[model samples]
Target: MKADVMPKPQNMFQAYMLLFLISSGQIGVGIFGFQRIVGMHSDHDAWISVIVAGIVSHIVVGLMFWILSKHESADLYGIHQHLFGRWIGNGLSMVMMVYYVMVSVTIVRTYIELIQSWIFPTFPTWVLSMTLLLLAWYGITGGIRLIAGLSTISFFVILFFIGTLYISPIKYASWSHLLPIGETSPWAIMKGTISMGLTISGFESIFYIYPYIKDKSNGAKYAQYSLLFSNIIYLFMMIMGIVYFSKGQLTRSIWASTSMLKIVKFPFLERLEYIASSVWMFVVIPGLMIYIWVLGRGFKRMMGWKQRMMTPIICFVIFIGSLISQDREHIHMLSTFTGRCALFVVFLYPVVLFLFQTLILGIRDQSDKKGAAE
Candidate 1:
């Protein structure tokens, strides 16, 4: 998004806060749970799946940024309407809105479930969900620019806490288990990459914020770097998860990365994972906030509503949706289902949009040639 949408950054770094903010959103609660899930399908070579996910994510993110740069000023809702025409575009916009709202709900359910299983076993999810909804609503009301600015600090804190992964917990890594990488079929990696696709849906930021880009010409480059950077982070996390947890350990475990930290001891504390995770709340917060904001943006443009009223309205809806998950099992089912659904928008939509737009571009070019000849 253009830097002008919320605060006009005085410097280029401030402007690039959008990049960091978007990246931060991409690095949310999912990272905690992903290792266990990836290990299920890919084994210790699951690290390879993350690398695969990074490549696919980079291509999809690149496509999204390219689409945004082409238009220069319009958001995804606008692009949908432009590409599909009024009725079809508006319908697609509605689907996209539902798609985004589903994402916010997924984040809420994921966060609350994480808290319940790992930390606050007695906490009521409704209260937890409502609390997160309200906090995110506050950020949204403040505007995307604030979220953009806050992302830098949030990411730094997230990184600071993540430093624990480099410690003795890593000694748990068994090299022999991972010796035969790609021992699995090509189809296994491809199928498992689908789930990893769910883990990397943060690229939606470009669609929502294209209007705020400071220089449209460099939008693609900035987005490209963001993809590369996120890939590195994800791959590292995956490798750590595989090395520390082992394939058998990861296959059966939930929140394997965070759980692995439970064994980590410090001179000062024993339950280091709890301490590390206490701060991760901030990391996931921005992600939930930005997604809610993105959904609201799509709705506002589609329906001509004001941001002020729309932000709280969507937060309420997401909070209610999150309350529906009765237990960890239900939340797990929802995550699996939604992860499958998001595959379409995250990986397939860009390809579809690119084909649609490419045809449009070709026709326009042909028209120009004919006009020149005439």
Candidate 2:
């Protein structure tokens, strides 16, 4: 199965780091305006969609660990090979590599778009792209341990920024806007659940990071906590968005989370959204670092390429791609495509794997018992 090609286990991350890493990954780009998109279909009942999606995410995380628990030391590539044989498995792994790369690109570019639209209309895209990519490049080269530490930083820093919502957005909210909930049809709520699925897709990073956990048995628990935390944050933000903006205003605002900052005027400070925007870089950086690192790690696993070399090249490609995709429409298309792809990769794929593994084990156990009886 070419398992020997996988790097020898080195120092591993602790259980807590799993919480930080998974949370950091899931909480990015999507959280800002996820309410609007999900709301478009489900409307005020969108928070219901968030809750349902969170439950689904918890289930998916459990299934991921079920699969990983069966093959304790293997990553997704190894699991694929075990289930599908060498050629098909490697091909699937290749596709995952491409998905990871696209994730990194979409995230970095979207953040860049946010910057250009909100804070710096005249700023050159390439400059911001290059600068962010360089920082990500440096972090990825330090390997997963450094990346985990970065996630820890992102988690705490983001909390303070999240606290800002309490100051302004909550005051503007009308709880009546969220009333008449459950008024949406089941089909509509399910559609919103699907949208929330995309927003919460980053938990799939666990597939790549699983083998590195120091306490493998506790891995699933920490992952569930991470997903739980993300769900809470997402739900809170979506509710705030619903109440603060009228139905029309909520749907129209692209970055509703940041838009909440406009009401956050202080005696000494003005343009609080700008302050929130600046702090968002911290929130965004961890996701970019982890996804980019995953892309590099995927290359290392499949082709035996050095992650150090692969990272900068991937970053360069993302930079050039960002430069080319300055149009808002183009950026939106990229995000939509990535979101759809992630729904399959992150949510559905693991369930299929877990079922296949369970069936195979059952059949093998029957054969063994029959042989022993003979």
Q: Write the per-residue lDDT of candidate 2 for residues 336-358, one digit (tens) a residue.
A: 88888988888898888788889
> After TM-score superposition, what is the CA distance of residue 153 in candidate 2 from its true location, in Å?
1.2
lDDT of 1 by residue, 1-374 (tens): 12123325542233356557767878888888888887777776777788888888888877776776666467777877777777888888788778778888888888877788778899998998888888888887878777876777777876676664556766777667677878987777776777787688777777776666666667767676766777777887888887776567777777877887887787888887776666777888888888888877766677768878888999889988988878778888988887887898778988899888889877888999999999
> How does model 1 fare in lDDT?
0.77
Where model 2 places Cα greater than 4 Å from the true spot, the runs are 1-10, 361-374
Best by TM-score: 2
Per-candidate TM-score against the hidden true structure:
0.92, 0.94
User: Which lDDT values do the candidates have, in the order given?
Assistant: 0.77, 0.83
**Model 2, global lDDT:** 0.83
Highest-scoring model, lDDT? 2
Q: Local error of candidate 2 at 338, Å?
A: 1.3
